[model samples]
Target: MIVFDKVTKHYGSHKALDDVSFSIRPREFVILVGPSGAGKTTLIKLLLCEEKPTFGRITIDDKDIHLLKDRYIPYYRRQIGVVFQDFKLLPNQTVAENVAFAMEVSGKPDNEITKEVMKILELVGLKDKASNFPRELSGGEIQRVAIARALVFQPKFLIADEPTGNLDPVTAWDITKLLLKINSLGTTVLLATHNREIVDNINKRVINMDKGRVVRDRRRGKYDYK
Candidate 1:
């Protein structure tokens, strides 16, 4: 479980997150929706241990991640996977090489890198394109490559930030479905998006934020209170 207890974040005199609290259970698919500057990104940064909370603690599986030593932070981060709106793929590297690069940088053996890269590329439905460069794939396929890269470590938590923002509706839904499929496969998914269509259709747990606070939360929720 991931718990945020009375979390608060302040930048100078402006507060980015205000006394927010929430808990995400294991294997849960949760949508976080809010307008800009509602603290969604701030909260994610805290959860990823990229920033420290001004007051309060975040615990994962009963462990306080902020308390983890600097040397252990890398190990801790390996358990969490994050995908972003921009597909950050290397233009020069092929799909397989892009995914394999993640493991290689972490010191995995060449044999294991080859094996796991194929396994994840297959999982993201990109095995056939493994030899193709990023320029050869579509927007959705580029995003798939990014996702495959994130999955290389078999992370327990898969957090996506506006993953479908750049795609067409049809393609966006395809990516959304892909996320749903990943969640069904037992990975906890925290999707931060303001796309009303996708949010209304998913019908999963929704946490609504406004002005740095959680205004409402509902199971099988819609995009708005109305």
Candidate 2:
């Protein structure tokens, strides 16, 4: 459902991505693995339309993303969800409110918003923390809240950038298991992470990028790439 055609990205004189090309089919769980400065974040920024490619094209469902109008970008993003390394939660908003905020901003009906927020909370195993603030939750719980918010819209594609960055190995596995579950339920998962153990344990599709190029692509493989 997603394709990158010889995509290249540059910042001033430095190249961040160099002719990177790949396609991710529907319901496929793909992991982007590489060391620092490997252009993983740049790839995501291009997908989110936060940055334009210096060359080549990015297409989603056959539509060229760069050609899309700015005003329609948000609408397009509704089909995709993004979770960052840092949980970008509203410190003052309750957990329920934070998840509900996305639907509310989209102009969804009040009843629909309520139902979706509740369902997503349950999906992320955070129903009991509905009224709690971010400060009251552990790192793992906070990441779960972020995942809940990302999944609230029932997005077709979920892109998580270092989702388990700050968690313990055990908690990281919990998060990866959740991502796998989401993938099994038909959402495409693209995880960008450097956690070797988690990536190896996943045994899913791994795309290793280095110096702006995809150095390795494997299906159901271990993380032995350097």
Candidate 3:
């Protein structure tokens, strides 16, 4: 379980998050909706332990992540996978190599890296593009490589911040479906998106934020918050 208890973050005098509280259960698919500067990215950053909250506690699986030692931060982060709007793939690396790079950096064995890279690529429907470079793939396929790279750790939580921001509607929905499939496989998904069509169409738990505060949270909901 992931719990955010009265979380608040301050950037100089600007509050990025204000007294936010929520809980995410394991294997749950949650959509985060908001306009610009709604604090969505800040929330993800807190979860990733990239930034510490000025107040409140963020506990994942019962551990207060902020209190973890610096040496342990890397290991703690391995438990969660993150994908961003910009599909950060090396232009020079092949799809398989891009995915394998994550493991390679972690000192994974050559055999294990090869095996897991193929497995995750297949899961993302990009196994056949293993030899293709990012420059050769479509926008959606490039995003798939990013997702595959993020999953190399087999993270329990997957935070997708604007994963569809770079795709057309049809392709965006396709990626959404892929995320849904991944959630069905038991990884908790937290998607932060601005696309109303996709958000309303999803019919999942929606957490709407504005001015750094949660304005609405609904179960089996849409982007209808006002």
Predicted model with the maximum TM-score: 2
lDDT of 2 by residue, 19-96 (tens): 998999999999998888999999999999999999999999999999999999998887788898998999999999
Give candidate 3's TM-score: 0.96
Candidate 2 at 80: error in angstroms? 0.7
Candidate 1: regions farther than 4 A off: none
Candidate 1 has an lDDT of 0.91
Residue pairs that clash (backbone atoms under 3 angstroms), model 1: none
Ranking by TM-score: 2, 3, 1
Per-residue CA lDDT of candidate 1, range 46-106, in tens?
8888899999899999899999978887878778888888888889999999899878878
* Model 2 local distance difference test score: 0.92
CA lDDT, candidate 2, residue 130: 97
Instruction: Give the total clashing residue pairs for model 2.
Output: 0
**What clash count goes with each model?**
0, 0, 0
State residue 116's C-alpha deviation in candidate 1, in Å: 1.4
